[model samples]
Target: MLNLAKIGHFFLHLWRGVRELSGDDAYVQYLKHHAAFHANAVDVAPALSRKAFFKLWQDSQWKDVRRCC
Candidate 1:
């Protein structure tokens, strides 16, 4: 099974990538053009669910999940 800490780390990386991509005009244009196609797309796990996930995450003894890499 994948560790929760690793999962959190992966999400952090994904968020960063999204932020960066959103800043690029080309990416923005692509998103605009493909808005309908990707409209239903959702993150594997969302940042909003972090709090709930973290509670379970902490219970897993992965408390250092937030430690800077």
Candidate 2:
């Protein structure tokens, strides 16, 4: 029998796994990295919009793929 703490930990891990698999955290991480990368540059352009980001991501993902299983 699982205790409440065990069950809660399992659900937390499951939620995090789903977020990772779904790329839900990608944009947030991108913003963080982008901010760090350009912290002192000051001349860089703005970040990509969600639509543009997804388009670019999809394009890159498909560019080198030979077949889909």
Candidate 3:
């Protein structure tokens, strides 16, 4: 039983590492930042929806020049 629990915890850590490497965890980070920085402001808008956050992220990724001249 202890070994089984260890394996499950290992997989959970591995999955989070993969998400961090692949940028799948960006929204989670964004939400954390928003909660810490903006959640208390009454005039601040709410955090973006998942779909909207991804849309905005994708747009920002391509709206700049990435290569050196």
Candidate 4:
């Protein structure tokens, strides 16, 4: 039973690492942050939908127009 639990944990950690490295986990973090800090705030707008959030994230990531020579 201990070995089985270890295997399950290993897979879970592997999956989380892959999601993090691939940028697939950003939305989940964003949601958690929003829920923790802004879900009840009076002035903040509601959280962005997943599609909008990704669009905004992508835009911000590439918006600086940096060039590497």
Taken over the whole model, the C-alpha lDDT of each candidate is: 0.57, 0.83, 0.90, 0.91
Best by lDDT: 4
Highest TM-score: give the candidate number: 4
lDDT (10s digit) by residue, model 2, range 1-69: 759999999999999999978888777777888888998996799998878887777678677855979
Per-residue lDDT tens digits for candidate 1, residues 1-69, read 879999999999998788766542334443454565666777532232435544554466555564665
The residue pairs found clashing in candidate 4 are none
User: How do the residues 1-69 of candidate 4 rate in per-residue lDDT, one tens digit apiece?
Assistant: 469988999999999999988789999999999989987788998889999999998888877865788
* TM-scores, one per candidate: 0.32, 0.69, 0.67, 0.77
Give candidate 2 misplaced runs (Cα > 4 Å). Answer: 1-6, 66-69
In candidate 2, clashing pairs total 0
The order by descending lDDT is 4, 3, 2, 1
Single out the weakest 10-residue window by summed lDDT for candidate 2.
57-66
Positional deviation of residue 12's Cα in model 3 after best superposition, in angstroms? 0.5
Q: Name the regions of candidate 3 deviating beyond 4 angstroms.
A: 63-69
Model with the higher TM-score, candidate 1 or 3: 3
lDDT of 3 by residue, 22-51 (tens): 779989988999999986688988899999
